[model samples]
Target: MTTQTLDGVTVNTQANVYFDGKCVSHGIALADGTKKSVGVILPSTLTFNTGAPEIMECVAGSCEYKLDGTDNWVKSTPGEKFSIPGNSKFDIRVTESYHYICHFA
Candidate 1:
């Protein structure tokens, strides 16, 4: 898959902070007005609560995650994606720095 750049989109550079600064993301709006974030996670375990459903695409590296109400952890690598439901929380563990694109729906 190819990554599309959102022209004329204003990015929120200080949004979506997690793990006390270990994980951070910037918000961007698509041409159709869909919101998303491109972020990087450091090697750490973090839990995040979502207000809307999210599809996280692994752009570089990999990470393991367990969704809310799920006991099994799943691994996602570059080009792989995982979905999380709205109003839910999920845990993620990363060994190395992981880069991802988060699409909010």
Candidate 2:
């Protein structure tokens, strides 16, 4: 694992980075043991499945997402966030490089 101190909090990066060509993310464990991921999604439309509830905070660029059971796509930009339920799927479309921090709980 790799470790880095951000804003005085040390985060331990998981050894296996998650990627599927369109997006890449590194899992991190916060000092308080919270699991999270910081990642960039390349310009593409992708579907993702989650095992736990997630709160995604956008840090750069923007993205449009349609949550499970929703037909409308919500737009989110920097400083914005969206939540997804556990054991569900969501679709996201990014026009540019989108950076985000995902908090898993």
**How high is each candidate's TM-score?**
0.88, 0.84
Clash tally for model 2: 0
Give candidate 1's error at residue 69 in angstroms: 1.1
The candidate that wins on lDDT is 1
10 residues in a row with least lDDT, candidate 1: 1-10
Model 2 scores worst on lDDT over the 10 consecutive residues at: 1-10
Candidate 1 clashes: the total is: 0
Top TM-score prediction, candidate number = 1
Q: After superposition, how far is residue 34 of candidate 1 from its true place, in Å?
A: 1.0
- Candidate 2 stretches with Cα past 4 Å from truth are 1-5, 9-19
8-32: candidate 1 lDDT, tens digit per residue: 7768867788778789889988767
Tens-place lDDT digits, model 2, residues 22-87: 787777666777778788889999898989999888888889999999999999888888999999
* Candidate 2 similarity to native, TM-score: 0.84
